[model samples]
Target: MTAQTGYQDHKTDRLARLRRVESQVRGVTRMAAEDRQYIDVLTQINAATHTVQEVALGLPDDHT
Candidate 1:
């Protein structure tokens, strides 16, 4: 079985994602200073992008 609520449920998830993105940015900065692998940094960035997209899609439409 599956269950769902509307935008209310999404709010927490979105905030959590934003926090993760913030952390990732910090990590990337550290990685750059340490001269980490390019592919590793790219993967982290890609994950952050997907998280943003998911949050955007979960938002409710004002017109609806």
Candidate 2:
């Protein structure tokens, strides 16, 4: 594929990952609002954190 095509595809993938992270945050918010168990909410928060970190870490590699 062409360079621009590859970049567009990667950008699309990154956007999708970010959207998933957004949904994860929303879920966490809902859980907190509903007074979910502390451990459960904490677990989801950790998951969201990890997902965002993964996306961030991939950014440098994408530039390379």
| Best-performing candidate as measured by TM-score | 2
Clashes of each: 0, 0
Model 2's lDDT to the true fold?
A: 0.84
Lowest lDDT block of 10, candidate 1: 55-64
> How much is the lDDT of residue 37 in candidate 2?
100
Candidate 2: regions farther than 4 A off: 1-9
Task: List candidate 1 segments past 4 Å from native.
Answer: 1-9, 61-63
TM-score for model 1? 0.71
State model 1's lDDT: 0.78
Candidate 2, residue 34: the lDDT equals: 100
lDDT of 2 by residue, 1-64 (tens): 6445334547877888889889999999999999999999999889888988987888777666
Q: Estimate every model's Cα lDDT from 0 to 1.
A: 0.78, 0.84
Q: Name the best candidate (by lDDT).
A: 2
Instruction: Write model 1 residue lDDT over 9-55, tens digit each, in one string.
Output: 45677789889988888888888889999999898888878877877
